[model samples]
Target: MLYKLWRSFIKEIFLLKRDIGGIVIIFVMPLLLIITITLIQDSTFRNLEGAKIPIIFIDNDHSEVSQNIKKELEGSKTFRLLTNFNEKTAQDAVFSGEYQMAIVIPENLTKDLNANVDSKVQTIVSSFGLEADSAQAQKKAPKAKELHLYFDPATNAGFKSSVMNSVNKMVFEIENKKIYKAFQEQLGTTEDIEENKNLISFKEITPLKGEKEIIPNSVQHNVPAWTLFAIFFIVVPLSINLVKEKSQGTSVRARISPTPYFVHILGKTFTYLIICIIQFLLMVAVGVFLFPYFNLPAFDVSGNMLSLIVVTLFAGLAAIGFGILLGTLAETQEQSAPFGATSVVVLAAIGGIWVPVFLMPEFMQHIAGFSPMNWGLNAYYDIILRHSSISQVSKELFLLFLFYIAMVAISIFYERKQNAV
Candidate 1:
């Protein structure tokens, strides 16, 4: 039995080696896919982080409040604040979509704010009977100052909300400082409390099991995701090869021989599993060595190498199992070729290969759980990004194993049923 299986394996290796197109499809094509996608996504990340949003700042007030707002915008380094345009021109530009948004600080904003704070402070002093000259306490509060924001019609709601929230917070802080200053003057106690900007702050942390604090980058993200895709893409060639065997009487000779059909299947699966591992190594090599030449981030494979290899093996098994099942179920090249290609694509789509599962709609995210690719992807992510130990990624790994077992079982059952007929 061992000799038979070894011969079968040797035959598969020789046949695949001679098929130049198959080698290219499994190896060269995947490398190109990963490189191209990583480059594109890296540029997108740079644009999102480093691109300055140009916003029109129409400072009709031209006072401390407007100037402070301008200072804040400039300090953020997020906006290229253009203050030259007047109300009419800025409004026109924003409405016409030449600019994403505009901020128009109302005129006399400082004066109105100061007057309102003074009147309120006087009222407080007079009510408390703490001051002799409290006649100004009766002065009515100035009408509410209006700060106008104009947005381009093409702007998304997310950008609009972010701009509005930032502006509101800034203006609210300025107003509070003014009120605090009034109280300080009325009480005759002097200390600067208004400039306390860092009184509160926020931070985000991505916890990893390892000490290395590598920033997540496009290459790290794309390499694993597309590697999973390329692994599963083996279904196409595997299924076609099976159909071709039947057409060319290869299956007939194997069946009439003393060797069992299952040995042939095992040999094919083993041969292609080796191919999957090689493909995986090629992708990682490109990310680690070649990407730096392109000025892209290098892939961080700093986690447990054993865990990474374990996950890759399970994922390869799952892909190879599905390929064998597809080949067994399909009868003709015409049927197998299109069906295998289309199935891999559809699986990739729903499996968080094309997009992250969290970004999908709720129902689609739930559906992703059924895809074997998703299970493999999650396992890969755990090992690569989270630095997860084998125990930590056991659930996804178990699911992949079960999927592989299920596919192989179904294929064996169908093959037996057909043979009995």
Candidate 2:
């Protein structure tokens, strides 16, 4: 019985039936999609480099502290500071796309800074995750004052590199004696030091070993997440393939064989599941070996690789079950293809498959929690981003395991319903 089931599973996979174009659609198309979408996102982000994000600075206090703050804006690479103008005109510029951010230093700014008070910086940023055109129009009218940043979160490396460069430039202007004296006071050192010793101490302020790891937030977060998203689109074409088999009378013929219905489905699923694994490895290879700047941290290749592979395979199985359920319900591939594909695509967007959910709106984050992609991503996040132990991912693992069970149940019910007809 075991040998028969195994042979039947193998037969279902080879299809023993021929459709050259169907194989191409199932296997080849997903590869193209992964490549195309990755390229498009890369190009779009690169294009944003040329965008001129304007910034208006309002200095209500005409003091040196206010002037120094203005100088800070002048020194920043993210903002092109506009001249001081009335509140109405400054606000109007944000609407006109002449500025994307506005900073207003209140009349008490100098006093606050001098007194070392923790005063709030009144920053007028564009609304949260709104469309640019809408933001532009709303800026013309009075919108709630929300603090938006001119530095693009999508582009900036958490302002780390830029900040380091700015520090290098600013250091030339700083009084070296002030820092040394402060250090001496903190260390309880003698007030007088030899001239040669002072010179040597000045040169010793270079960066310490491994200090470069201090700041993060770069393309690393986006690249792996988005690459997996493109791979997830594979469910669409694979679902269409299954639907085609049904319409063509192939599935019925296979079902009547000695094989159990589940075994037959498993074979076709395994083929595409293997496809996903290959694509995942390809993306990982490109990320770690090809692009250092965009690379994800090296994955654990020890015992963890096998567990990771199993986790990823279960995710593919869930997708396959969803595909089959959709395929069996629809009368034709034309109807089923769009239904499955559109649903996955939309779910991917909501599930933080493209961008981190933390970066999205609170509502969207809540919505993403309902998606299987979110569980898969969270699993990946635990392993890759947080460097979690297997035990540490218990919550994500349990949720995904439950999702797999639910999908299998649904697939079984859908299959029985289809067979009844």
Candidate 3:
């Protein structure tokens, strides 16, 4: 009986053999997506590197201090000075992509600083307002005050970070001069205290720790997220095959034959399982060969063998089982396709696939815990990033095992009901 069932399953694989071209397309999709997104991300990185970060100066003061501030920036490597001081010209330059930001040293900037008074620096980046992504654009306004040091907001952390280092150094130099002068006068020494009088120097100012590393290859993030999505989408083709077999009366014929109904269903499951395995292998191969980012290591903290086996087994089981359950529940291609696609997208978005959970709201982060993406990602992190063993992921592995069991149970029940009539 087992031999017959195995033969039947092998027969089914060839019976509804998928179009070679279609299989090729499906297998290639993930790799193509990886390549395209990686290119875009790399291009953005390149554009940000050598391309000039242009800033327009609007100095309303026309004073020595304001001019000095302008020179200080133009002399530094942080920005290129675009010669558009007026608001209209600078705004136009920004909108036209000729400049990234504008620095407005408001009227009487020097007078305010020298007098120990408060003043505001007006920084403008494209009229579209601040791109939360561009630290350079958001910082031009604050860099305006680095020349005088006292009036800067110090609120924008990046701007404050760089400014603070310069300010610390300047303060130390000033204090050293004062100390040297006092000592020289007291000792009646003729030594010069003009240039080299350096006092307490800032060794290093560490920026805030745990700043999220920017993903250089966006595909590293996108590919895994979208692959999960495509796996969900595979349910459409699977379900359509089921319904098609039923409509053509082949399923009824199989039921009446020596093959048990369960064996017939097993055949269908095998078909999809083979396809999925092939899809996985092809995607991984392409990622490793073409993309240079495939085969993210499995987490393994302790040297335990059994735990690692369990984690991989349960994860694969859950993913495949979910695909099967979704296929069984769907009645038609049109109905299944959209649902499958949308479900993947929604689940990925919620699961911290697109944007990491840390960036999401507190409530959303909690909600993401329920998604398979979260479980999958956590498992991946444990294996790939954390180097954890399967036993270390007992909670996640168990949850996936349970999910697989539930899905299989539901599929069996549903198929039985449909066959009973």
Candidate 4:
């Protein structure tokens, strides 16, 4: 039985080696995807980190308070201050896509603040020129001393929120200082104000178990995700080969001989398992070695190496088991090829291979938990991102093994029923 399985495995390996396209699809395509996606993501993150939010500042108030606010904005690295313009010019610049936002400090801001009256500033945003006709047609617009904010409708929501938060913080500080000064004037004491200067503070906390580290970049994510995607793709070729053998009466020929049906299945599974492991190692090698050469982040594994190996082995088994099931169910090469290819794509989509599971809706997230790709991704993340120990990934390992077992059992049951008939 062992000799028969070995021979069958060797035959599959030889057959695969002769097929150039299959080899390229299994090996080269995944590396290309990982590199391409990682580079794009890295560039985007770098741009975001270095980007400065541009804002046009029109300080019509021109008072001590307004000047101070202008100086503060200019000093902030988060904002690029464009101060050489009035309200109309600033509004036009924003409309022409020259800036993302605009701010106007209303006249009598200092007087209103000093008198303890509610004060407002005017902010004008471009609105991406959506209502340009209506805005231009208005012959006379009422002048109000209120904070008028104008924003480009096409601007990213997160970027807009960040700019708003920073501006609001500055406004809060300015108002709080005015109130504090008023209190000092009424009470005739600066000692109380100085004593309560630090009434609020903030601290950051990490939810992971290990020492907090910088979050892994796109290379880390793409390498593992595309690696698993490539592994699952092995089903297509495996199914096609199995369908060809059945159509050619190879299975019948083997059954008439001394070789058992289980040996044939085991042989094919082992061959693909070897291929999966090789594909995974190659992808990881690209991350660790090739990525750093191009100045991208390297794949640094801080967790137990043994744990990574264990998880990877089970992941391979699960993928191979799935391929075997596809092979057993497929009647013809044409039927099996599309089913195998499309099923892997669907699995990758729902399993968080293409997108992070957290980004999915709550219901989709719940469904993703049932996907083998989800288990594989979680296992990889545990080892690579979380730096977890062997014990930490025991549950993922167990679930992966259970999935592999279930797939193999289903495949065998179907094969036996066909044989009995």
Candidate 5:
């Protein structure tokens, strides 16, 4: 049985060696994919964090409130304000996609803001028995004040949300400061109340491993993701080859041989699984060694190398099982190749490879939970980013192993049924 499996593996290897294109797809293309995608994403992250987003800012109020807003926005170091164009020009620019969005401060904003604050202050003072005249305390409020935000049609919801939140927070702070000053004035206070800058501070933290703090960058997140992409991509060639063998009568010849059917399955699974491991290693190597040359952060799996390999092995088996299932189910190269490739892409899309599952809609996120690729990716994240132990990643590993079993079982059942017929 061992010799039979060895012979089957040798046959598969020989056939693979003859197909130069398959070798390129298995190795070269995945390397290119990881490199290209990591570089693009890394640059985007750097730009978002380090490079200032240009925003067309129009301060129509030309007063303390608007000026303070401008000062706060600039101080955040997240935005680079463009104050050159008028509202019309800025709107046109934003619409034309020259900029992301435009902020238009309503005219008399300072005056309106002051009026609203003063009315509230007067009402509060009268409540405290400070005001002698009830008529004076009932200060008439101004008209509804509007702050206009003109966004580009192409702006994503996240960008719009971020802009709105930043602007609103600044406006809220300004209004509160004005009210505080009024309160002090009304009470005959001498010293201005010092604002508590650290009243509500936020610090983003990623999971830490004993002594090492992992600041996740593109390379660390992407290597495992695209590696799984490349692993599952083997389905295309694996399925097509199975169809080719059937078309060329190879499966018929193998069926009548002394070797058991499991040998053939094992043969292909081992061959492809080895290829998957190689693909993963190459991707990690590129991330660790080549990324620094391009000024990108290095991928570090120092403490979790064993865990990474264990998770990757299970992921490889899952991918191999899927490939075999596709190969067995598909009847022709035309049927297998395109379907295999499309299914991989679809899986990648919903599996948190193309987009993070957290970024998806609620329904899509639930659906992503079922994707085998998602299980594998989460396992990879555990080992590399989260530095989790094998026991910690057992759930994902179990899910991946279960997926592999299900795929292989379905393929075997279908094959046995067809043979009986």
Candidate 6:
């Protein structure tokens, strides 16, 4: 049995060496994708950190309070304010992806504040714009004295939240000043209000102890995501190989030998498992050495090395099992090629390889939990981001093992059924 297994493994290795296209797709393509994606994302993150968010400022009020608000925004490095922007033109620009957010200070803002009447600043988020009837559009448009903040739908939620928080703070300070001035006039005193002396204060509390900081960058995300994508993509070539063997009567020849069927299957699985490990190591090397060489963030594996290894083992097994299952079920290379390739791409997209699960819709996030790629990504993140130990990722590892077992069992059952027929 051991001899037969060894022979099968060696055969697979030689066959793979002959298949130049498969080797390039499985190894070279992933390296290129990871480098390109990481570079683009690193640049984007740097710009976001260094450059100010551009916003259109339409001050119809032109009052002292409105001017102060504008001054506050300008003083803070958070925003680059573009003034005297036409409302229609701004809205069009935002919708067309030229801008992220727009702020409109309404008319009579100061007058309403002086009278102690409640006034709303209109926020016209570009996301709110949609094709609608004239009456509906008119009804949805910003009313008088409303401060409208228009936001693009495609903008990152975290970025939008940060911008909103800053805007709200500015508005709060403006209101607080007006109220303080009113109180001073009523009390016949001209005392100035001190900074940061508001009635309410906010404090942030974090769960992490000590000064350990975990700042994950694009390298941390893309390396594991594209790795999983590449691993699963092996299904295409693997299925093709299996179909070719069956068409050439290799299966029948193997059955006639003294080796058990499980040995043959295990041999194939073992060969692919080794391939996956090598692929993973090559990708990790890129993250560790190549990224930092280009002035980009490198993979920070501050967690237990044992934990990373255990998760990676199970992830490779799960991916290999899936490939084997596809190989067994496929009747021909033509049928399996498209099915394997398309399924891997679709699963990767759904499993947060293409986008973070947090950024996905609520329904999609729920669906992502069931994906094998998501489980692998979660395990990797546990080690990379959380700096977790082996026990921390036990659940993810367990799920991956379960996926592997299920796929292998199904593939075996299908093979037996085909043999009987």
lDDT values for all models: 0.86, 0.58, 0.58, 0.78, 0.87, 0.80
Q: Which residue runs of candidate 5 sit more than 4 Å off their true CA positions?
A: 131-136, 195-198, 210-212
User: Could you give candidate 4's per-residue lDDT for residues 1-421 as a string of tens digits?
Assistant: 7788899999899879877777887899889989988898898888767877778888878887788778888887667788898888888887778788898888877666654421111111123332223432332433434766667667778877887787778777877877666544444565665456666798765445457555667887888798889888888788777777789888789778887777887898789888988898898889888999888988876545567667778888888888888878899877888888899999999999988889889999999999888888898887777777778888888888898889889988998789885
lDDT of 2 by residue, 298-318 (tens): 323333565566557756666
Supply candidate 4's per-residue lDDT for 331. 94
What's model 1's lDDT at 217?
Answer: 76
Q: Rank the candidates by TM-score, best first.
A: 5, 1, 6, 4, 3, 2
Question: Per-residue lDDT for 137-207 in model 3, tens only?
Answer: 34323223433222123234565467557535543444445455544543468887665634665665433
* Ranked by lDDT, top first: 5, 1, 6, 4, 2, 3
Best by lDDT: 5
Q: Which 10 consecutive positions of candidate 6 have the poorest summed lDDT? A: 117-126
Task: List model 5 lDDT by residue over 1-421, tens digit each.
Answer: 8888889899889888988877898899999999899889988888889989899889899999999999998888688999998988998999999999889999999999998888888898887877534664577888977778989999998889988998898899899988989888878887746644647789887666677675778888889999999988888888878888888889878878888788899998888888887888898899889999989988887877788888888898888888899989989888888898899999999999998999999999999999989999999988777667999989999999899889989988888787774
Best by TM-score: 5
Listed in order, each prediction's TM-score against the native is 0.89, 0.63, 0.66, 0.82, 0.94, 0.85
Mind sharing the TM-score for model 6? 0.85
Comparing 4 and 6 on TM-score, the stronger one: 6
**Candidate 6's residue-wise lDDT over 40-97, tens digit each?**
9889878978899888999988888789889998988778999867888888888788
What is the model-wide C-alpha lDDT for candidate 1?
0.86
List the candidate 4 regions with Cα displacement exceeding 4 Å: 56-60, 64-69, 83-110, 117-146, 191-197, 205-215
Q: Which digits, one per residue and each the tens of the lDDT, describe model 1 over residues 183-284? A: 888899888895567666998776744585656778877888999989998888888788778788898898789998889988987888888888888888
| CA-only RMSD, every prediction | 2.7, 13.3, 11.7, 9.2, 2.0, 9.1
Clashes of each: 0, 1, 6, 8, 0, 15
